[model samples]
Target: MASHLDLEEQEQLEQVKAFWKRWGNLITWVLTAALAAYAGWQGWNWYQRDQAAKAGAMYDEFQRAATAQDADKAAAAAGDLKARYPGTGYAAQAGLEVARLQLDKGKADEARQSLAWVAEQGSEPAYRDLARLRLAGLQLDAKAYDDAAKTLDAVKSPEFAGLVADRRGDALLLQGKHDAAKAEYQKALAAIDKTQDYRRIVEAKLATLGVPTVVEAAPNAGAVQ
Candidate 1:
């Protein structure tokens, strides 16, 4: 009986060995891949955090230079941020700041260059929309009505719908398309929220264009509480 048990144990050991021989390499590779992927994910997260920290520091430098009214230093810091962290929000904000400083210095062409970059390549859609809006405004000021209309047409954010309409109205007004401008101002007024004071400004614009104002009714006072 002891000999028989030894023979059964040896058979079981051999069966185990056969299974390992069939699948050992595949199992080892699977585990190695999983470990490598986990390490890569960790390394990527660490790299992103480090990049963000560096970008934040550079943005602070930009803000300090802008506050001090040093356009050259601000532009340098902004350029550094854009070069090192173009995927970051800091880069987009830096572009806006640098463009503003350029505008303050009466460098309209330089401002347009910076704004065009943000409009085309910003990492965030909201920032891109803002860049387009500001770019349209600059084009309007430059009497590039066709370009301003095209830029305003590119704004896709619903939040800016009213503002886009208003700017489009301005472009049309400047092009001597009074009827089209009035229609756009009407659209702007319709899109704007009643709570926003900007609605009143739009209404005033419409009035200036000889569009009769329709008084909005006051809200009910909640049935005497």
Candidate 2:
């Protein structure tokens, strides 16, 4: 019996060795690739954290300059942060802050330049949209009516659609296109929430133009809210 068991165990060991001989190199390569991938992921995570830390320090400098009401310093710091870390959200925020500071100092041209840069260079859509809106406002004030219209047209957020349309109406009104202005204003009114105070201003604009109110009734024709 011992001799028979020893022979069976030897045969099983030989089969295991044959299997390893066939697949050992393939399994070893697969495990090596997996380990390399995990190491690469850890390295990438470390790099991102380091980048964000550096960007944050630069952004803090920009914020401090802005808070001190030093427009030149704020602008300089913001520009540096933006140039060095344009991929950071903080950089875009700093741009907006700098633009606001420039505007408050009555530096329209400088503010417009700042806003234009933010509009063009911001990594985040929200900051870009805000910059575009302010830039359009500045253009409108400068009597660049068509340019303002074009800029506002690029703002894609539905939440800002009404305000953009309203600004377009103002531009059209300035250009003596009364009918077009009325249509744009109507679109603004339609886009705005009825309960919003701003809707009253739209209503008043439409009223002044003698355009008939076309408020569509809610779908629940007979039910009370």
Stretches > 4 Å off in candidate 1: 1-12, 214-225
Worst 10 residues of 1 by lDDT: 215-224
In model 2, how many backbone clashes occur?
A: 0
Candidate 1, 65-175: lDDT as tens digits: 999999889888888888889999999998998999999999899889889989988989999999999999999999998898888888999999999999999988998
Residues 1-225, candidate 2, lDDT per residue (tens digit)? 999999999999999999999999999999999999999999989988887899899888988888999999999998888888888788888888898899998888998888888888888788888888889999999999878878897888778888888888888888888899999999999899888889878878778888877668789988977
Per-residue error at 112 for model 2, in Å? 2.0
lDDT of 2 at 20: 91
lDDT of each: 0.92, 0.88
Clashing pairs in 1: none
RMSD of model 2 against the true structure? 5.0
